[model samples]
Target: MAVMDDSRLAEELRLTIGRLVRTVRAVDTMPPGEAAVLGYLDRGGPLTTAEIAQQRGVSHQSAAKTVKGLLTQGLVRVEAHPDDGRKLLLTLTPAGHDRLAEERRRRADRLGRAINAVLTPDERKTLEAALPLLSRLSTHGTGE
Candidate 1:
């Protein structure tokens, strides 16, 4: 029997995980794009639509659409940038923060249950130990 290459196995695992993530539901009234924008705001504080687009790797027009949707939903508000009167800065409302927190909690619970189901105690320990390396891989573009 031949062993599979590590890189091939990792690619398969990443694809499977991505598919699974796409299926999970977020507990927000907003659409996925709006929710993603809110999540980014929750993490990064106030930012302009262009900045959000850059961070999300999307076109400014797409980000503007998302911002408009979020503004309509009352999940975010726009204010004149103090330093730049021509630009607007977007920030989450209190309701948006609450919604984001709830969504995060729901996702965490779902992930915890799934992790508990498939992983043995020792495997769980190993995963916990490997989390930092995995996080680095995720953040540093090494995993892809």
Candidate 2:
């Protein structure tokens, strides 16, 4: 196989991934910021607003606003921090988990339909084989 230029490959992958994310997210009604906070909590467990901000690389005010919106929607609950009396931690409620699961199912169905309708058998096999590489690329520098 001919080697592709590194920068060109990166740009192609970046654009493709962004498009994929947008397509998947189109089924959900939640605002991006609110959904993001919920997704972070779903993966990372309970965290303070400050921790969420730091993890997301956003300003504290931005994180706080996101958390507040989630709170208003009953998607997340805030509890007093176990180790700190003055701080609060945010966690996903049962409804939030259900919403996440439903959103995932919808996205999966949409993507699966698109793939089946558009891609050949060989292309499907190629995508199946690429899953691990894509996962690794996403986590490469995160120290996960």
Candidate 3:
């Protein structure tokens, strides 16, 4: 059999993943950046504005703006950092936790429904089996 064109395969995978992400994100209450910052905090624990910005691959000002929105929504709050009164820490408020949880549920449900409705049982199984390969592909260039 002829070898598959790596470029074509890469392009197809990139577009497919992008569309899938966009579709899931469309149902989310929070915008992508805000949701991402919230997610990083939720999983990685509280952090400073600069830390959040670094982890999210955005500028300090951009992260601050997103944080400000979260604050306005009462989703996150700033408090004095322990062991360092000079610095402030950002953490999710009770409302923030609730909002993130709901957003995640909605996105997962939307994607799950689409997969179940669109893919046959065998196809779903095939996709499930490809998870490891897909994950490897996703992290291929990363030093993780």
Q: Clashes in each model (backbone N, CA, C under 3 Å)?
A: 0, 0, 0
Report the C-alpha lDDT of model 1 over 1-144, residue by residue, as the tens digit.
787699987998799768768645633344778778988898888999999999889999999998988888788999999999999999999988987888878877877887899899999999899889878767895343
Query: With candidate 1 superimposed using the best TM-score fit, by how many Å does residue 79's alpha carbon deviate from the native?
Result: 1.3
Better of 1 and 3 by TM-score: 3
How far does residue 54 in candidate 1 sit from its true spot (Å)? 1.7
List clashing residue pairs in candidate 3: none
Q: If both were scored by lDDT, which would come out higher, candidate 1 or candidate 2?
A: 2
For 59-134, candidate 2 gives per-residue lDDT tens digits of 9999999888888888899998999899999999998898777777888898999999999999999999999999
- Angstrom error of the Cα, residue 23, model 3: value is 1.3
Estimate TM-scores for all models.
0.84, 0.92, 0.89
Tens-digit per-residue lDDT, 50-69, candidate 3: 99999989999999999999
Q: Residue 73: error of model 3 in Å?
A: 1.6
Model 2: how far is 138 from its true place, Å?
0.9
lDDT: which candidate is best?
Answer: 3
Candidate 2 global TM-score: 0.92
